[model samples]
Target: MSLFGDDELPPVTARESQLDFWNQVAFERVQAQFKSGSMHHALLLLGPGGIGRETFAQELAQWVLCQNHSQLDSACGSCKSCQLFVAETHPDYHLLAVEDEKTQISVNQVRVLIESMQESAHQSGWKLANISDVAALNQNSYNALLKTLEEPQPQTLLILQAEQLQQVPATIRSRSQLVALSVNEQATIEAWLAERKGGMTEELKLALSLFPQAPYKAEDFANNGDAVKCGDFILDISCLMQGNESPLALAEKWLPDIEDCCLWMLLMMRDLLLLQQANDKSCISLQGQTEALTNIVNILNNQRLMQLNEKIVELRSLLIKKSPVNLSSSWQALLIYCSQLAQKTAKSA
Candidate 1:
């Protein structure tokens, strides 16, 4: 699963940088809890994907485990605990998540973490376990976790991060305090990107438009050529709308990365919806494709656009859930729907 891929965990330094702008508020909340000595044993950090929820959780875990964290709630970099954390070998810290290519975190994984909680803290400080994707916890895993959450471990902090709170079991959510994170202002994000990368490119701008809530991901997409692929996908779909491309051919071409293609199509459908409603264009994801989107809006009415939007959303949801799907068939079906909508529009015209 892409959500739990074998990507290396960002080092403490990288995580610190990732949390630069969005951390202060969430950090302050955790700090206050720490100061009052009433910190919740389990904290659920809720936010959109790519908005650094996991990084925030890691930062909070470090703050709790740091032996010499000052009153300002900052981790003292020179402390032994801080060093161990930076080295990603903090004996008192544990990270639990679905392994690479796994659809869910297994019961065995949860049991191991739970058993680890039974041991004493290695450094006589807080023992922190950060669960990166709480939503990916299977039923058995969740039950195992629920048991631990119900029976609190003193000085043990469990940080749960998920994009959607509704996916988490109600019993577990009720036990854990919730902290929501969101994107910073556009200007703030752009300024940060400029400072970090020396300048912003068109790819970065489109990435920001696509993932406004996640500056880090936007930057990554821009740097790693994913942003360019997204652009090409948009252009290809625009060609499809013009009847110049075969949906089956396009679907076959994008079979390897159909999830991303679906995501791009969803965003394009969103832009078309906005344009049909005469909403502000600033909210559109495909910044330079306004002419193509406007042409699409001209071809489709609001109702048709809405129907297409629903179809695209359903497809995206299925892809995200890792459901068994025939990608080519699905894409062809969507294209057929679009073709039918266009025909209906022409008849009405």
Candidate 2:
């Protein structure tokens, strides 16, 4: 299980194959700042989740700490610093993230990290601290960190990785330089996935479609058979919308992974909405299931699609809050709503 107790894939580390393809430009910019001796004391790396922001931050930390970093900005694995980093025992390097049983990074944790930052580095170089999820920092934590950001220690670098700038406090965001990472081109991601995971299949394609910015996640989903499960879900939902399958049975089949199933439903409904507007198959995410998707799309109007989308979004919000909601009831209601909309659309047609 991952940090969140979910079966999601782990974040890619510095040791993972050379930085993600999309990180090269951002890497070069930082390398230039490093070379010029103008590197920011606090740097914010922002991007969509699962797109390697944390991995890039780790890679930057390693490179900055390496005594014999190459011109190409690669860390020398043989160096003592590199050794400690790879072993995760570097005294000067700290990774602050939310731990188990914690919903957010507490103010106490931030204070502790601030105290550590005040101390001299054990090594003869920069003391590096990486906060993997800045969004998890609450208001008090952010205020505690804002002081440190304003008066950073000498030769210290703090790297913050967050999914978006909006989640960060304006004060903290202003004190740091932002480096945004985006999804690579489709061809680039497909090529990388093909090389890493052997030949590309329909499962891989669909996974890529679902997580276009995070190829590592897409690859993981494909490798772990989640992609196949997603494909089957799309087909099942399509059948249900066409009145060929039972929503109750489908809901029962998906209860084991209700969150993922709901996500798939939202994506399908989004695709249907896109199809209704664009009248094109290219806008959909379920790559090879255009016919099925089109059938589902044709049976629903934009209003019905929007309603289902809203319901799914609300269900997801409830799940995140860990509220006392009956999962089966929520699923049943969602399916019933979709079935009613489909029937209404059919009668109108």
Best by lDDT: 2
Q: Which stretches of candidate 2 lie over 4 Å from their true place?
A: 1-17, 69-72, 239-259, 274-284, 287-292, 310-340, 343-349
lDDT digits (tens) for residues 1-349 of candidate 1? 3676536432333223345566578778788887888888988988877787877887777777776554435665556677898899988899997888987889999998889888988884688899988878887888889988999878888889887766677998899998888865789989888778889888888788778887888888888989778778777776776677877787778778877777778778878888767667787878877877877877888887788889988887776555568867887788777777776887778
What's the CA error at residue 221 for candidate 1, in Å?
2.6
- With a 3 Å backbone cut-off (N, CA, C), the pairs that clash in candidate 1 are none
lDDT scores in order: 0.78, 0.81
- For model 2, residues 87-197, the per-residue Cα lDDT tens digits are 999989989999899878999999999998889888647898999988888879998999999988889999998876666778888899988888757898889889887
Q: Clashing pairs in model 2?
A: none
User: What TM-score would every model get versus the actual structure?
Assistant: 0.84, 0.78
RMSD of 1: 7.7
